[model samples]
Target: MEATISLTSQDVTKQDPTALFSPKNPIPMETIFLSNIDQAVVFPVETVFFFQVPPTKASSTLNICEVVKRAVAEVLLVPYYFMAGRLNFNHGSNRLELVCNNAGVMFVGATSRLALKDLGNLSLPNASFHRFIHRPGLYKSLDETPLFTIQVTRFKCGGFALGFMTNHAILDGKSASEMFHNLASICRGEGLKTHVFPNERTSLRARNPPQIKFPHNEYVKIPKIPSLATSFTTQNQTSPSPLIFSNKYDHKLFHFTPSMLKSLKDKAITKTSSFEAIVAHLWRARTKVVFGNTDELSTVLFAVDIRKKISPPLLAGFVGNGVVTAFATAKVRDLVERPFCFCVEKVREGGERVTSEYVRSVVDWLEVYKGIPSTCNGNNFYVSAWWKLPFNELDLGFGRLVHGGPIVSGNDEFVLLLEGNGGGINVWLGLEREKMKRFMNHVFDI
Candidate 1:
C-alpha cells in the first residue's frame, strides 16, 4: 500500500536557501576541472539520515533546520566550498567542470504532525520518504543546478529526518562520508581541524598521447550523433538512469546475520570476506530469476576505491571521485547452475584486476574516448556495499541517529548492502512486483 501524506504550507516554512557558505571563508570564483571518473557520474545521489530526540523540554523548542543550516554555513561549507557552486559544461574542452562562483545550495525546513513510530519499519526503503527531500529540477541545465540540496523535516515527537542530495561528479562515497563526519564534529562545537580539503583534480589528469594499454570492456563509445551538449535531464539515457521515479518496481530489504554470513564463507572453496560471499550469492540468485536457464551472458558491476591504487597516490584528503568500476561476467547457465563459490571467485578476480596499471589504463582510455559515457545492458547488475560507512556515528547535536541509508533503491538491477541494527547485513533492492516475490523467496535459499 502507498503511504498517504499531507504537508500544508502553514506547517512548513522556507529560509534563505542561498546562505550555504561562511562569510569569513569566502569561496573563490574559478572553474575547477574534473576527472573522467568525476564526469562519469552526472546525477545527484540522494540519501537520508533519521534522528529521534527524547521528549525533553529543550527538544520541543529547538529548530533542527536552523541548527543544521548554521552548522553547514559556519563549518561544513568552509572546507567543502565547491559544493556551493554550479556545474557548467565547457564546450571547448568537451568536459564538465564546476564553476565556483559561490552559487549557494538549497535548504528547506518542514514539520509534520505524524510521529516517527507511525512510519512502518524505518530500516526499509519507503517511497513516502521522498517527501522529505528537495528534488532538483531534472530539466534544468548544469549551470542552473545546485550542487547540493538538503531538507530537514521535524516529526510530532521532536524527531527529524535530514534528506541530503549531492552531485556524484563532485565527490564519491568516501569524500561524502568525510564531509558528514566533519559536519557532525562541528555541530558538537568541537570545530573541524581535519586535513586541508584536497581539490586537486589535475593530479589524475589524462596521460598525454592517451595510452589505451588495457581494453576497458566496461565502457563503450557512443555513436556519433549531433551533440546537443550535455543536459541535466536523464530522459532517453542509457540503462540505470541517474534518478529513478517509476513505481513499477517493489523495494525490499533482506537481512543476513553474522552466523548466516559465516555459513556462506565456509561453503566457499576458499575463504572469502563478507562482501564477496554476500554479493556472489545475490548475483547468482538474481541471474537465475532474471535470466532463467539460458546461455546468455550476465555481468555484475561494482566500484573499487582507487585512491591508493594509482601511482603517486591521490592526496590523503582528496575529495573528488576516485573509484573505478570492477565487473565480472559469466554465462547465465554457468552463473546459476554452478556452485556459489564459482561466482565468488569471479567477483574476487574482477576486483583483483584493478591494479595501479589498470587504474591508469582506465583514465587514459577515457581520455582517448573523449570521456564517452559507459553503457549498461539489460543483463548487467550493479551493487554497492555501504555497511562500513560512518553514517551511524554522525551526531548533529539535535537527536540520535536511528536509521541512515539511500533514500530509495535507484533501479531493480541495483542492490545496496547496508549494515543492519543487530550486527547483520541488510540488502536493499528493487524488482518488479512479481519478480520481487520470487527474489524474496530465493534470497536465502543458499
Candidate 2:
C-alpha cells in the first residue's frame, strides 16, 4: 500500500519581537564564522520526528495547530534572533554575516489516512517523505532562504510526525534541540523557559590581521604565504563553491543493541568510546565492501563538538555551529587488513590531536581562504553521531516520540549514528545499492 498525504494548509509566519531593531534599540548583527558557512556550500539540514502518542483527548486538529503556533510565538519572543536573521556578505571583512531582517518561517500541515505501522518499518524514509516535511527549494541565494521551516503531518492513527528543515549556518543540532524543547514545554502548559543564548560569538571571531598560530589543516589547505582567493573566488569568505553533482546512493539504517556495542568495545585495542569503536568497525567493513582487494587511499572525516575541547570550554547552553571535522586517512588494504583495535587507536589519537590550537587554526584558515574546497576530499567518508543528544524529553502534549533523525544526507559516504529503541543505537549509512547487500552481511556477521 502507498502512503498518501493531503495538504490541509500552509503559510509564512513572521516574528513579532517585543522591540524592533532601531537606531536606539539596535540588535547587534555579528557576522559569526561558520554560521553562514552555507554561503560556500548549499547543504540544507532536513530532520524528521515521528510521535506515536495519539493527540490528547482535548487535542483536536485545530487545537494542535494553535498549540504549536502559540508555543513558537512565545519561544521566538525570547530567542527572536531565529526569526529576524538572514545571511549576507559583509563587504568590510569580505565574509558572510548574520544580518537581522524579520524574513519569518514557513509552516505547513498535512494529513494522511495511513497509520505509521501500515507503511512498514521506516529504515530511511522513501523519496515521497518530502511530502511530509518542510523542503526549502533552491533559492537565488542563501539570503532568500528562511532559517527554519516546519511541517506537521498527522496520521489516521491519531499520531503525528514533525519534519524540520533549517539552514546549517544558522543553528547547529544543539541549538535546534533547545528550541524544540521549548516548543514542547509550551504545548504542555509549562510556560516556555529557555537557557540564555550565549554571547560568545566574538570569542571565536577572526583577528584583525588574520593571524595563523597553530596548524588547522582540517579546515583549509593553508598555503605557505596565504593568498586569499580574491580574484578566482567570490571575495566573501563563505562564498558558494562551484557545484559538483554527486552519485545517487541508496540510504538505509542498521541498528546495534547495547550489548553488541559493549562486545565491540571489549575487543578494542585500548578502551575507546562506544562511538569511536563503532566508527572504526563501520570504516573497516565499509572499506571492504566498497573496494574489495584494492589499495586505494580511503579517508574517514568525522565531526567533533568543540564546546568542551577549548581551553575555556564554551558554556553548556552555547549554540550555533561549534563543530569541527577531523580526518583519519588510511590505505584501503591497511583499513581492511589491520586489526580492529588498530583503527580504534587511530580514532583516539585523532581526537587527542584536535586541541584548542587546532580548532583556532581552523578558524583562521577558513577566514583567510573562505570557500576553498579543502575540508573534504573526493575519497573521504563523512561520519557524525547524535546518540548522546537528548530528545526523549521533548514531550509536547504528545507522549514519548517514536523516532527522530535527519532525513537527508549531504555527503556521499556519510554515516550518522543516533539513539535507537531501548539502549540500542541506529547506524544510518549512504552507500551504493549492490554493495549494500554485502554491507548488510558483513554488518550482521560482526
Candidate 3:
C-alpha cells in the first residue's frame, strides 16, 4: 500500500497562540526541573493517527492547514506551556530545564492521492508509511526542535493522516495524546475543556537534600553506547537480505482476540493477571527465539505510573514524568524451561516492588546521583501499554480514528501493547530480523 505522498511547498510555520506576549511584554522567565525519568531519553516519541474522512463541512470550510492552524492557536492558549516552553541545556549550569521562552510549535501540511481503502487496513504500521511524518528522529540541538509538532496528510478519499512528534522530556505517551485530543476538540468546535496548569513537574522533582533508604538494584546506570546515530524507518518485515537489515531491528504487529487472551490468562501458573500472562509468554518466546536456549540471562522492564499511587495523589492535568521502571531478571533457560505460571509469578513479583514508597525512593536515588536517568540496553526487554489511553477519543472533526498508535522506528528493543479493534490486544513487537521471523513462527506454533 505504498503511493507518492508528496509534501509539496509545505508551508512550515510556527503556530503560537495569537501573538499574546510580544518582545516588549515578554513572558515571565519560568523554568521547571526535568526529572530523571523525563531526562532518561534523548529522542522524540513519534505517533501517527489516521482518520476515516476529512473534517466535517459543518465544522469549517477551511482547508486542513487552516483548521489545524486555527485549532493549534486556540489549544495553545490553554496548553500555553507547549508554545511558551523551550528546552535548554545550560552547559555553564550543568542542567536541562524547560525554559518558558514564548517560542512556538511547528506545523506542516501535505497531501496524498491514495484513499483509505486503497491503503487497506492500517492495523499495523510498515516502512512505506513513514512519509506521513515531518520529523521522526531527534534534532541536532534543542533550539532547532520545538517541544511539539504536527503534520497532516490529507488523502483524495476524504481521509487524512495526522502525525505528531513531541519531545519525550516534555510529555510522555499519556500527556501527548491528551494534548492532541484537546486539539481535536478545539477543531470540532467543542472549545477547551481541559484546565492544565503548567510546572507541576516540581511535585515529582528530586528533593534538594535527596534521601534514599529503599534498595534500588533494579535501576542500574545505562552504559553509553558507542553509536548515537538515530534511525527513522520501521522495518515491519524482514526479507531479501537479512545481512543488509541485520543491523536494524524488525517490528511486527500480533493480534490476540478476546477469547485467545482470556484462554491464556486461564492457563496461568497461578492466578495471574492478563498483562502478566502476556508478558510472561512474550518473555519466554523472545528469549527462546533470540538465544535459542535458556543459557544467558534476560531482563523484562515495565514502567509504573505513580500518578494515583503516590501519597496525597497528584492532581488532574499534572503534566510531568510519573512512571518508574520495574524489571524482572531471569536466565533464558529458567524463563523458557519453566512452566507458564512460573514466569507469570516472577513478572508479578517484579511489578509489586514498585510501591509508593519505592517510587519516592527512586526520585531521591536519582537526585543523589545527580539526575543520571536510568537507561536500558538493547539486550533488555521493555513493554508499554497504550490500551488504557483514550486513543478512540481522537475525533478530529472526522467521526473517530481508523488506526492509531506509535510510528515505531526500526528498533526491536521495544514492545507496545495496543487495544485491538476486535476487543482484544495488538502486540507490536520489535526484534532482530531473523529472530522476529522465528519468534512469530514459534508464537503461531504454540
Give the best candidate by lDDT: 1
Cα lDDT computed for each candidate against the true fold: 0.75, 0.62, 0.65
Q: How many collisions per candidate?
A: 0, 0, 4
Model 2, TM vs. native: 0.81
For model 2, the local distance difference test gives 0.62
What residue runs in model 2 are displaced by over 4 Å at the alpha carbon? 1-42, 54-61, 122-127, 208-217, 220-247, 291-296, 371-376, 409-411
In angstroms, the error of model 3 at 263 is: 2.0
Clash pairs, model 2 backbone: none
Per-residue lDDT of candidate 3, residues 1-446 (tens digit): 22323223332222332232212213466676777667554356777888775445323322876787667765544455544456777667555677777676666777675666666667666545656766523424665556666787777666777887677677767677667878887888888758655546767766667768776655554333323222211111111122222447766788877887787788784687778878877887887887744577787877777778877577777676667778777888888777777788888988888777777788887655443222234566678787767777688776458887776555565678888867888888877688777888776433
C-alpha displacement of 35 in model 3, angstroms?
1.7
Ranking by TM-score: 1, 3, 2
Q: Model 1 off-target regions past 4 Å? A: 1-19, 22-28, 57-61, 193-195, 224-243, 370-375
Query: Which structure among the candidates has the greatest TM-score?
Result: 1
What tens digits encode model 1's per-residue C-alpha lDDT throughout 1-446? 23434344554444435447544444347788899778766766788888888888437526777877888887777777778888887878877788877778788887766777766567776656766777667656678778889888888889988888888789788888888788778877788848588898997788887777877766545443223222122312432233355667777778899888888888787989988998898988888777765888777878898988888888897989888888888898998778888999999988999998898788888776643333244456678788866678888777788988876644565688988767889988777788878887788986
How far out, in Å, is residue 57 in model 2? 2.5
lDDT of 2 by residue, 1-446 (tens): 22433223241222222222222212454344443223333345677777775446314543465557556654553564544456676667666666666555666666666666654555444445555666555434667666677777767666677777776566667767887787777778886656577734556666666667755444444243134221112323332232212344666777898898888898894768888888888888887887754678666767777888876787777766666667676788887777888888877767777888777766666677764333344335667687776765677766457777666433354577877767888887766678877888788555
Taking all chains together, each candidate's TM-score versus the true structure is: 0.90, 0.81, 0.84
